[model samples]
Target: MEQVPLNPSRYPTVDYEEVMNSDEGVRKWTDNIYRWGFSLVDGSPATPEATEKLLERIAFIRHTHYGGFWDFTSDLSMKDMAYTTQELGAHTDTTYFTEPAGLQMFHVLSHTGGSGGASLLVDGFAAAQTLYREDPDAYNSLKTVLVNAHASGNEDVCIQPAAPFPILSHHPVTKELCRVQWNIEDRAARMDVDAATLVKWYDAARKFNEVLKRESMERWFQLKPGSPMIFDNWRMLHGRSEFTGKRRVCGAYINRDDFISRYLLLNKGREEVLGKI
Candidate 1:
């Protein structure tokens, strides 16, 4: 199905219980997530048990070198910006990995007394598609430009020296828009290309970013305590606002294949059950 980024007013919050217990709920949630790149889950508890059950309801957890589930609080030693008090612009996480986490979950266990700490989400795929439609040359340039991303350090090594990959890539089998990979924080500064193409690449990047920040495409909401959200990491770009006060978040990541598999299985099961009736 062709997906587009929509205003959150269209599909606000989804009930957590239905998604956990009802087959139809699973299908609808899957469809909504894939279509909109996100769904805010409000009916689930903000506990580890609830998060674990939610993952089980959809798909199993994806274990990486970062481990299964995460409990994050602001700290000086934070390797990632998600654990800091500073504001972040819209971007995908773990771009350094060869295949970054395809899905992300964030459970707000406690967000009391926090001001200016609301979370932001944007549809990166929508921005890319807009570029493709309006500026074909820039869109093609983005797909052709190869950039290096690194995620290794003293004790950990995922892809040493990084690997060169396109900012935009289509599925090999389906030849459909499969990945939109861009992370300014993780991007290697050494633009390993001729001057002319490098200029085009930057120009494309500017266009994409401009669309991503348009006010009409934004969804702003405060993540109060006990509200957990699950979103597609591949298609959506998320960010955070700077805040003062305590904020604790917990959740896990799931593989892209497993998510798609679960979605397919659930849809099939529903179809089969309905057909029998």
Candidate 2:
């Protein structure tokens, strides 16, 4: 298949045949279909065992209690979450984590009572690179800024210790640039800077954000009943469109290194068999 550029209007439907049969094929397919992520097999599994088997193939499994099975909740710590009355703005998950997980999978257990809750993905690596090329100083400033994210409620509900991280980072495996900053709900208190420098930094960040939003390079897809969406959490940022009614999803996070290792190991086994032939 010819490669498709990331564009919301021209997004292509990924065929199941290309995704489920083999690791190598899936890798190539993911490179093309998502250029950022992939949507895998959908349809009610024949049995619970099949569901477990499919889930096992993935690297991680996780959930959030604040959002129930059908909860359409936003990551409340970010300012963009405030602008969004119904939909989440584009962003990578867990920028606060010291080492953010590389991949994320969302299984759509059900989506009956809603409409317009589509998943939106943007190539953060691509966006950051664009910023680097167009505004190097701004990009550099973003890299140095230590973002602080926290919550003050119950220990379980509040983010502990106010995690701090850079706004941009190089991908551990691909070495590609990826955006690591998100929702400006909280600022790092530990970072001490002159008033003038702080204002300049915020201005630069705002400019970079405008560039990302105006680029029109986002891919949008709806997770309907039975289909699960798997994405490179490190490379692509994800968001959801607002919708009425209920929208429940099951999610899991797997280390990117783990997935790459599995992919490589499976390929090595194939190479060994071919050598005998």
Candidate 3:
């Protein structure tokens, strides 16, 4: 069965204060993130400290080379393109890691002297499902073919997963669709597969990319201070529109294990919460 594409507008925003104080609010907020793969928090304190606190409210931040709680702007301090004033296509973060960050939070502190910079989010699960129904061969190719990715912009540092991973991954125990890893910008040029298989994989990847960019599958919105967004990195691809001004953003990553433990505990004994991830 094809999963319905996510529409952030349909979900209600939960107040940060309520979430921090009430169990019911926490349930609603967590449920929104699990079901829709994302949630927006209202009435949050607009500061880097507040952003860190809000993320810690859910789970401890997973510290990476980028650091635990980031407050960055378009200064090119980092080697990645995210620090540049350019358009970034929809892609999941930490693709080069053996275990990618599970959840990502974003709080746009400020944006000035720019007209564009609307956020781009696409439901990768929905896009994959659509491709399965429309082109099974392409879907299967993505499911079976292994691809490599790397992060090597840093002068003396480089990162890549120990082994290549397929675009579609299923949980070993549950055999359920657990991840959708797709990042054209991060994909490595050297693939381990034969030329014939690599050709098929590229063709499949193109088709999958097309599906991901479909208008119906994309949710576009502008980020504002005091309103933060938490999204599942495993199920959604996030990006931004090109802009020419300074933009300050702060956020952090939450480990998959920590997030799942928190979710299961918050909704403990409520088997209904065990819906398809």
Candidate 4:
């Protein structure tokens, strides 16, 4: 795979300037993203321009129903809890969409006042592995059972119908862990499987959620302004703690394939050394 799995003890950080300026920066940052499914870019300019410029390094920003790139805060108009002070549980975004976002990038424009709103991320692959080893039966159910998800109430912004996807999905060929679809808020009733066995799937989901929430499995960090966080939407579950005062963030999503394609092209030569390993 040529990817280094994450070591939870140490946080991963890359230089924003380096990624925007140097070729080696592109290789290093992309490699880290491939390895960890997430990476932090420190020392970014606290401006909208920085966010746009940064995304360009990988590919064009993905224009979805949410718009290409936008800034969001405690705006009452938002249809989602993310715009409010509520603490969000660890979950993946856009689970209702058949082709959900592939990569998401966030640049904290500002975070002030009461001490909270720290970012939370759980390694889905790691959590899935834990489930496989500890409760193979539950893991099997999650890997095969289809769950329903829906998105609506934002008017023309989004009115997606409920979609079905296995909670534990893998790469079509590699059989590698791909995405963990776990969103409590967007989850609808499960009607994809036989009613008699539905309870078993729910039990598996509960156990998976328990593993995801285990204190040791989560990574929490206060992403203050000038710090940009980019993560694989498919491989990592993200959420935030409740906070007071102003907290604004600007970000966007890039198509998953585009991001992967860019990385493969930029790091093509470097693989010879990795191949030797």
Best by TM-score: 3
What's each prediction's clash count? 0, 3, 0, 0
List residue ranges in candidate 1 displaced over 4 A. Answer: 1-12, 152-163, 269-277
* Tens-place lDDT digits, model 2, residues 19-43: 4555665455344323535445545
The per-model lDDT (C-alpha) reads: 0.77, 0.58, 0.86, 0.83
Against the true structure, what is each candidate's TM-score?
A: 0.87, 0.72, 0.93, 0.91
| Candidate 3 to truth, TM | 0.93
- Which residue pairs collide, candidate 2? 62-252, 69-248, 70-248
Model 1 alpha-carbon miss at residue 121, Å: 1.2
Give the distance in Å from residue 46's predicted Cα in candidate 1 to where it truly belongs. Answer: 1.8
224: Cα error in model 1, Å: 2.3
Q: Per-residue error at 254 for model 2, in Å?
A: 1.1
Could you report the Cα RMSD, in angstroms, for every candidate shown?
Answer: 3.6, 5.7, 2.8, 3.4
Candidate 4 on 28-81: residue-level lDDT in tens? 887778788888887889898888988889889988666788788888566788
Instruction: Please write out the lDDT profile of model 3 over residues 121-146, one tens digit for every residue.
Output: 88888888899899999998988888
| Shift of residue 260 alpha carbon in model 4, Å | 0.3
| C-alpha-based local distance difference test score of model 4 | 0.83
Candidate number with the higher lDDT (1 or 2):
1
Name the runs in model 3 displaced over 4 angstroms.
Answer: 1-9, 270-277
Q: Decide which is better by lDDT, 1 or 3.
A: 3
Model 2: CA > 4 A from native: 1-35, 42-52, 60-85, 151-163, 171-179, 185-190, 267-277
